[model samples]
Target: MNAPVRRRRRRLPLNVLLGLGLATIVVAVAVLAPVIAPFDPMRMAAGPRLAAPSLAHLFGTDEFGRDLFSRVVRGAHLSLGIGLAAVVAGLAVGGLIGLVAAFAGRLVEAVLLRVIDLLYSFPDTLIALALVAFLGPGLVNATIAIAVSLVPFYARVAYSLAVAERAKPYVEAARLAGIGSGRLVRVHVMPNIGQSLIVMATLGFSSAILSAAGLSFLGLGVQPPSPEWGAILASGRNYITKAPWILIFPGLAICMTVLAFNLLGDSLRDLADPRRTAPQRAGA
Candidate 1:
C-alpha cells in the first residue's frame, strides 16, 4: 500500500498537472485582480474605445472604453465566488436530503426520491432560468438559482452512495453492534462518500459558473459595471463583427476556466477508480 501510494504520488499524469497549473493560475488571478489589473475595471475611457489587442491594452477596450483585460480579470472574482458559494450550498442541502432519504423508512424515501426525480428531469440551465426569473435578477438571486438547480444532481449522487454504503456487510455489523444510525452514517458512510463528493463538487463548480454566466448574459445575473464575464459577453455581442476582441477574450477566460475544472474532475475520478489504480498497485 505504501509503495503504491508513493508511486501514485510520484507519477501524476501530465493532464492532471496541467489542470492543477491552470486552476492555480486562475485562482491566483482572481485573488490578485485588484493588484494585477493595470487599470480600474469599471473605469471608462481606459483606452481607445473598440481598440484591438495591443501592448497598452492586452485584451483591448470595450464599447464603454473600459479595459477588457482588467474587466475580465476582475470578473473572475464574481464568477468563481458565485460558483463556489452555490456549489457549497447545493452540496449541504442536497447531501442532507440524500442522507435522510437513504436512512429513512420506505415511504419517506419514495417521496423524497420522487421530488429529486422531478427536479433531475429538467435541464440545469432551464431550471436556473426559471428560478432566476421568479426570484428576480442580480448576483444574489443568480447564486440562489444556480444552487437550487444543482440540488437534485447532488442529492441523487449522495443518495446512491449512501444507499450502497448502507448495504455493505460492515454497515450491517455496525447495526448489530448497536451503532445508532446517525453515528454509523457520520463515522462510516460519510467518509466513504467524501471523495466522490469532492469529484462531484469540482465538476459541479464548472456547471455553476456556466449557469451564472448564462444568467448574466440574459440580463438576470450580475449587473453592468460589475465586469462579470457573461455580462461582458452580452455587452460585446453587437460588436462581434467590428470589435471581436471584446467578446473573444472574455469567452476564452470562461472556456479555459471550465476546461481546467473538468480536467481536474476527470483526473480525480480516474485516480479514485479502483480498477484503474489496482493495476498500478500490483505493479508497484
Candidate 2:
C-alpha cells in the first residue's frame, strides 16, 4: 500500500469513526430541526398528554402533550451550541493566557498560575452555579459561567505544553535568530501543541455540555419554554412515574452526545500521542 493511503487509514481509529458518525447525525438533526420536526416543539394539545411512543409521536407526548421527539430534536441545538461556544471561548482566552504565562517572567507566571489554581480549586459545577447566581439565570449567563469555569483547565494544559515546547532546540534556534517573542510563540509553539489542544477541546466540549445541562436542570441555565434538554429533563422529573418516556428520551440524548464526544477525544488523544500505538506497530 502507498504511504499516503496507509497514513490515511491509520489516521482515524474505529472509535473516532463511530463518534464522528454519531456526532454528525446529531448535528444534522439539530440543523434540520425546523424542517424535520413534525410538530411545533412548544405547542400543546389536549388529546395526547402523556401518550406512549406511537406513529403520531415517535418518542411519545409529554405531560403538556408536546411532541417529545420534536422537543428532543430542538433541544439538540441548544445543547450542542453551548458546548461548541464555550469550548471556543476557553480555547481563545485560556490559550492566550497560558502562552503568555509560559513565556513571561517569573512574577507574571506566578500570578497567572496562582489565579488559575484558585479557579481550579473549586468544583466546576459550583463555580458555574456561583457565576450564574451572580449574573442571574439565563442561557447566555450559563454559557459564560461554563466557559469561565473551563478556563483554568485549558490554561493549565496549555501552560504545561508550552513550557515543555519552549525548551526544545528549535525554539532556542528561533529565539537566537532574533525572531520576535510573539511570532516565535505563535509560529513555533502553537503548531506543535495544536494537536494536544484539539484533543483537550474535544474532551472539554463534553464537560461544557454537561455543565450547561446541570445548570439548566437546576433552573439556573436555559429557562422554561426553551426546549433545552436539561430544562426538558427537569420538567419531566415531576412526572417520572406517570410519564417515563418524557424523561427517557431527553436523558438518552444527553448520554449519547456526551459519549460520542468522549470517544472522539480518546481517539484523538491516542492519535496525537503515537507512543500509545508504538508497541503494536513495532510488533507488526
Candidate 3:
C-alpha cells in the first residue's frame, strides 16, 4: 500500500503536465493580447488586403485587409472568456440543483430529475440554437444559451455522485452525530464529490468553446466586426480560395484551445480516479 501510494505521488502525470503547459501558454497569449498584438485587429488597410504571410504581417491579412494574427490574438479573449464563463455557470447552477435534489426527499428528487430528463432529451446543439433563436443573437445570449444547454449534463453527473455519497456509512454517522443536513452536505459530501466536478468542468470547457464557435459560425452567436473565433471563421469562408490564412489561423486557435481543455480533463479524471488501473497479466 505504501509503495503504491508513493509511486502515485512520485510526480505529476505527463498528460497533466502537457495539458497545463499548453493551456497556460494559450491563456497567457489571450491575457496579453492588447500588449502583444502587432496591429489593430479591426483596422483594415487597402494596400495590404489579402497579402500573404510576411515579416510585416505574420499570419497575413484577412479579406478586409485587417491583420489576421492580431485578430486571432484578440479573438482568443472572447472565445476563451465565453467558454470559461459558460462552464462556470453550468457547474454552479447544475451542481447546486443536483446536491439539493439528491439530499432532499424523494418527491423533490423525482421532480428535479424529471425536469433534468426533459432538458437532457434535446440535443445540446438544438437546445442552444432554440434558446439563441428566442433570445436573439449576441455574445451574452450565446453564452447563456450554451450554459443552459450544458446544465443538464452537470446536474446528472452531480446527482449520481451525490446520491452515492448520501448512502455511505460516513454520512449516516455524521447525521447521527447531530450534524445538520446542510452542514453534512457542505462539509462531508461536497469534498468527496468535488474532484468529479472539477473533471467535468474541465471537459465541459472544451464543449462550451466548441458549441459557442458553432453557434457563431451559424450567425446565431457573436456578430461580425467582433473578433471571435467562430465569427472569424464565418467571415473567411468567402475568401477560402483567395486567402486561406484568415480561416486557417482562427480555426487552429479553436482547435488548440479545445484540445488543451480535453487533455487537461482526461489527466484530471485519471488523477481523481486512480483505481482504474490496467488489469494485471494472469499468473504473471
Give the per-residue Cα lDDT of candidate 3 at 257. 90
| Predicted candidate 1 versus true structure: per-residue lDDT over 38-86, tens digit per residue | 9999999998899999999999999988999999999998799999999
- Per-residue lDDT, model 2, residue 40, is 91
Which has the better lDDT: candidate 1, or candidate 3? 1
- Computed on alpha carbons, the lDDT of every model, listed in order, comes to 0.87, 0.85, 0.86
lDDT order of candidates, top first: 1, 3, 2
Q: Give the runs in model 1 whose Cα sits over 4 Å from its true position.
A: 1-12, 274-284
Local accuracy of candidate 3 as per-residue lDDT tens digits, 10-100:
5548779889988998899999999989888888892388999998999999888888899899999889899889989988998999998
Top TM-score model:
1
How many clashes in each structure?
A: 0, 0, 0
TM-score of each: 0.92, 0.91, 0.91
Cα displacement (angstroms), candidate 3, residue 199, comes to: 1.7
Error of 3 at 193 (Å): 1.5
Off by over 4 Å in 2: 1-12, 274-284
